[model samples]
Structures are given as structure tokens and as C-alpha cells.
Target: MTDDTETDSDSDSNPNQNESTDKQLISGWHGRYYEDFDVGDVYKHPFGRTVTETDNVWLTNVTMNLNPMHFNEAYAAETEFGERLVDGTFVIALAVGMSVIDVSVNATANLGYDNIRHHNPVFHGDTVFAESEVVSKRELESRDHVGIVETELRAYNQHGDLVLSLERTPMVLKRSHAEPSAAEPPGWPEGIGTQPEDC
Candidate 1:
């Protein structure tokens, strides 16, 4: 006699259940593996964020970054640009953070950045966005379960102007199911770094 209600654990009868679970697992960066990236791979963050006047003002004050170029329009008017400018550090932080959902959310450690260039100044009311391109990947010599990823980070404004550029390095797990191990890679290397061969 067979019990019709007894469900087989590996049975394909409940297709929706397995499908839904798979969708949930891959929905966020948490489950992404180093295998997900390769040279020339680019991940434009899923969404763009608008920068507000409050954002600029509060960030400037809270961080104690009271430079006239960022806070005092009257003082800035006396300078070459003639208006207050958004802090460069603010632009860098916000832009990089924007890309976390697609890049570093599953990363082990932020190795470092290189060839940082402030191409243009960001101002209040200017919305910023970021796109990261994976420029290089190397398997750790000692750690079989992780890899080093180098990325070229570019930030742009709503006006389609390049505001900043840099190379970011992070250690990412080679496989989501791999066991955790003690593997630490060195920080940014010295010298004329290689540029990402844009494809």
C-alpha cells in the first residue's frame, strides 16, 4: 500500500517550490561567487541615486569637512570656480557605495584602489552613478577557495560627465559552497598599474 500524501524529498512534483527558492538565493549579491566575474566583465549597478542638497550639506558638516569650496558659496564666489563645489571624498564614497550591490556585497576585503583621478567636480543637485568593470582576476597561490579581483571604477553625473575614476581590488569567494579558510592577500601593489583593456 502506498501513501499518496507522503512527498518525496527529491521529487520534481513541486516545481514551484524549488524554483522560488532558487530565485531567492540568487536575487542578491550575497550568493555571488568569484566565478561570477571575469576580465572585461562590467556590472552597472542596478539603480542610480539622486543626490540632494540636504545630502551635500549634511555630509559636509557631519564629516567636519568644512572646506569653503564645499560649504560657503560666498567664499567660493571669490575663488576661481565662483560657486560651492561638492566634496571630492563625498563623491568617491557615495559613488563606490552605489556599486556595492553588484560588486562588493559578497566580497571578503577591499584590497585597495589605484590610479584615482578626480576628473571633474561634483556640485550640489548633481546626481551621481557608478559602473564597475572587472579588469583582472588571479587565483591566490595559497588559497584554493578564493580569488583576487581587480576592477576599474568609473563615476558619472546625471549630465553624463565623468567625475572620478579608480581601480578597486577585493578578495571574493571562488564558490559560495566552499568552506571558509584563512586566506589574506596583500593590498595595492606599487608602480604604474595596468589599465583595464576596455572591450
Candidate 2:
């Protein structure tokens, strides 16, 4: 005679069963590895960011940009733009930031940027969106587990005008080499102290 019902000891015997259940419970956007990309594939990033007057003024001052067109409304009104123009660097930074979730979330390092061109001026209250196309990819000769992916990034304003464009390269890990455990939150180490006094 034999019992078909699974017992506690039977479940405990297979440690992977628990891990499988945990993986199923934890589900969301995990980002892409090197193998997930293909040349010419374009990704339209999900969110749009609105540039405000405060944003232009703060970034200009924080970076020590002495341009009046970025912060001084009175001075900017005298220029051909007739109003304050958002910092070009700020527009570039925002475009790159928006693409990170779709292109470089799993990347180990950003190789560099190239061919940056600002086509149109950005102003306050303008909403910006970004999209990226995988331009090229190649496996590293020295590092077998790592590969380089180059993408062409483009930014557009609310009216669909091209505001900026650039190409960037990122060093990404291959799916075969990436650590699966990294996807899960780490547990507290046994010997590590949680309280400041214990340290």
C-alpha cells in the first residue's frame, strides 16, 4: 500500500520547489540582457517628462551655467526665442535618463556617446519623450560573458518635433553569464549586525 498525497518531507526534499514558487510570486519588468536585443529593433520608452521653468532654472544654476537664456526670463525675452530656453545639456540628460529603463537597465557600463545633435530648442511646459533603436552589437573579445550594444536615441517634444538625437554604447551581460540570484532580493547575512550599536 502507498499514499499518493504529497507530505511535508516530500516538499522539503526538493529545495528548488520553494525557489520556483518564489520566482512565480515575484513578477514584473526584470529588464533585458544582451541576448534579448537585436539590431534595428526600436523601443518606445513608456513615460513622458514635462520640462518646467523651475527645472530649467534649477539645473542651469546647479551646474554653474552662466547663460542668461536659461534662467533670466527678462534677458531671454530679448533673444530670438522670445522666452527662456531650456538648457541643451538638460534636454540631453533627460532623454538619456528616460531610455535607461528600456535599454540599459541591466548594463554594467556605458561605453560612450557619439553624434549628439540638438535639432530644436526646448521650452518650459514642453513634454519630452524618448525612443531608442538598437544599432549594433558585438561580443567582447577579452570578456566572453560581456557584450557591447550600441543604440541610437531620439527625443521628441509634445508636438512630435525632433528635439535631440545621439548614439550610446553600453556593456551588457549575456543571459548565460548573468546571475539568476540577482533578480531576487538578498537576505540579511547571518553574522551581520542590523543595529548601529551592534556594529
Candidate 3:
């Protein structure tokens, strides 16, 4: 199979290469460039994360969602679910996050999300698995260096119930002159999004 990314002649493929003299090559694992995606490609993302109590409670507080069923066990046991519910927002966030490495890690910006659905409730301690399918892609006249990609994202519980779904549109960088996205999210300048120092 052909590799989609640029190959650097100076970069070493050997893990044992001299650390000081060798530069790491951009990897497909980090994310895909605009050219790498195709319509109808479905990606079952690799990472699965279990939701913790801290993840639910802290997020519920931070987002100002005071629903008792999420953080209060007493109120939850009386309900149909019979347990503290993991906030739906957290499920959605996790779904989006899971898609990032495969769908948007090299993206310039997330334009928007739509057609969201909460098909089921997620309970704390439930492991969430994510999957995404590329639905569409097109080049933008306004941004010649990038293209728009639309994907349908889904999150499922360990029992295989679909919990969340959404359609996301992102401006993905073209491989022509693109650089890897920042590994650290906080250091991006105000207008320019995070740009990794090395690609």
C-alpha cells in the first residue's frame, strides 16, 4: 500500500537511532490529512475509555448542569435507570474526542456539529467506545490549503447500545503544505489554532 504522507529523507525509521540527530516523522497514528480521507470510510476508533465518577461529577459541575440523576445517587436509584447517569454531554464529548485521532487530528478547525442524538443513557463505570464514518468531503475556495470533511460520530456502551451520535464538519489541512497539529492544546495563539512545532 502507498503511504499518504510526505517522507523526510533526513528522518530515521529506527527507534534506536541517535536521539539528538534524529527527528520523528509525522505518523498516520497522529491523524489523517485531508487527502487521506474518503467518503463512506468507516473508522472504528481504537481507544475505549470507561467513565469515572470524577469525570461525571466534575464535568456536570463545570458545565453548570445540576441534574440530580447525574451526580446524586439517592435521586438516581428511584428512577428507571436505578443508578447515577453519566451526563449525556460527557458521552458526546467522549464521542467527539474518540473521533479526533482518526478524523480531525490534522484539522485546521471544527466548523460545526449537527443532527445530534442521545439514543440511550450512559451510566458511570460504563466503558464508551467510539466510531466514525466519513460522509462527505469537498475543497474550499476560500481556504485553498484545506478542505471540508463531514463525519458521523457515534459512541456506544460496553453492552453495545448506542448512546450518542452527531455529525461534525471540520476544515482539514491538505497534505501539500500542512503541518502536524499541536500536541499541546493550550499554546495556540488567539487567532491561529494550535500548530505543532514539528511535522
- Candidate RMSDs in order: 12.2, 9.2, 11.2
Q: Per-residue CA lDDT of candidate 2, range 1-199, in tens?
A: 1344467567778868755432223334657789999999999999899999889988999999998989888998999999999999999999999998888877889999999999999999999999999999999889988899999999999999999999999998887876544224123343443333332
Output the better candidate (1/3) by TM-score: 3
Pairs with steric clashes in candidate 3: none
Which regions of candidate 2 deviate over 4 angstroms?
1-24, 181-199
Model 3, which residues run further than 4 Å from truth? 1-28, 179-199
The lDDT of each candidate is 0.75, 0.86, 0.83
Models ranked on TM-score:
2, 3, 1
Can you give the lDDT of residue 106 in candidate 2?
Answer: 79
Between prediction 1 and prediction 3, the one with superior lDDT is 3
lDDT of 1 by residue, 1-199 (tens): 1454455643556667755432211111243468888799888876777777677778889999968778887898998887788878778888789877777756778899789999988877787889999899888889877788899999998889999999999888776544322221123233323322311
**Each model's TM-score, in the order given?**
0.71, 0.79, 0.76
Residue 31 lDDT (model 2): 71
Q: How many residue pairs of model 2 clash at the backbone?
A: 0
* Better lDDT candidate (2, 3): 2
Clashes of each: 0, 0, 0
